[model samples]
Target: MKEVVYNSDLHFEHKQWNSELAFWEDELKTFKNRLSELVTRWTDKEVLAQLEHYQNQFILHGGVIENLQETIEKHETNIAGHSQKGDESMDVALVKKHSEFRYQMEAQRQIYADLKKEFFRFLSKYM
Candidate 1:
């Protein structure tokens, strides 16, 4: 029996990428808001300790977001590189690479979302 393969339409849609990019941008804004709240509310020693912990977590979250952004940029570069080549055979490879890149981008986006959720969870402890 041959295994069935599913290709998501998001793999080829510019709107999908734009939508995901917008999602992450909103997530970053939320993180900034939480960070501001933590800073404003840190008055006592216990709160300060919690604030320190959140500060570390925020740095780690920022790093993951940066890595995901870099992966997206790399995929864009790879697609651009392949598109510049005019050969039909290269187009086939470009399609394959684009699919793989989309999978990778989606995976990274999920990771970013998970990290954002974790950040919120950590912030909840202080609230």
Candidate 2:
């Protein structure tokens, strides 16, 4: 249990998270393009409605991914600064904050995965 709460290097975690977010950001473009193709191929009202729903979701999650990326970048900068200055109190607080961010990233990834699965299921049905 104690090990679960400990991270030896938050910088590595941040790097990993940033890489994943970047991948998702790129994948989102592909998803949007595929959705566009679906729109052109299928004109049924129900299909359009579902497409719109996914479009909105993609847009929303895109913004979320950007925000998280910005946040992680800023935190990484802060971590570097702290390392140079050696502020123990600030380091402690930052570690606590990093844990929260870790939780948030995990949750967001799970949600994104679910969205992708549902999107694929829709494609299988209509495409």
Candidate 3:
């Protein structure tokens, strides 16, 4: 309940309700953290689990890429790591071609970035 003051807008207020506002406020404040946590998340277990799985997969792939990059950098300090498309040795070219060929072949898969990009472009055009 609100107290009436002459200067306040409730100066001519109805005094039907009692002083319960403070009690309610205190009660709600006490559950603030738990209530907020309950309200902010997905309630559907299946959907939530699916989303979590997708996120985990994305993170896993990202971590694999990070590891591969770090190893490549480390090896690049050695002779084998420094090889490119046109080095003097056929071994260097063979190594480069093999890695590139595998990646090129894998690019045909659904998960390939360029294929996904093209799909999105097509979707944007028609949709």
Best lDDT goes to which candidate? 2
Query: Scored by CA lDDT, what does every candidate get?
Result: 0.62, 0.86, 0.38
Provide the TM-score for each candidate, comma-separated. Answer: 0.57, 0.89, 0.37
lDDT of 3: 0.38
Q: Which stretches of candidate 2 lie over 4 Å from their true place?
A: 1-8, 86-90
**Residue-level lDDT tens digits of model 2 in 1-127:** 2333223277778889999999999999999999999999998999999999999999999999989998898887787676667642344567778878999999999999999999999999988
Candidate order (TM-score): 2, 1, 3
Winner on TM-score between 1 and 2 is 2
Pairs in steric clash, model 2: none
Q: Listing every candidate in turn, what is its Cα RMSD in Å to the true structure after a full C-alpha superposition?
A: 5.0, 3.0, 29.8
| Reference-based lDDT, residue 14, model 3 | 12
Residue-pair clashes per candidate, as listed? 0, 0, 0
Off by over 4 Å in 3: 1-41, 79-90, 93-127
User: Top TM-score: which candidate number?
Assistant: 2
Model 1 whole-model lDDT (C-alpha atoms): 0.62
Q: Which is superior by lDDT, 1 or 2? A: 2
Model 1 regions lying over 4 Å from their true place: 1-12, 43-90
Residue pairs clashing in model 3 are none
TM-score of 3: 0.37
lDDT of 3 by residue, 33-94 (tens): 33334335656676455445444544454444444444443434333332333332334443
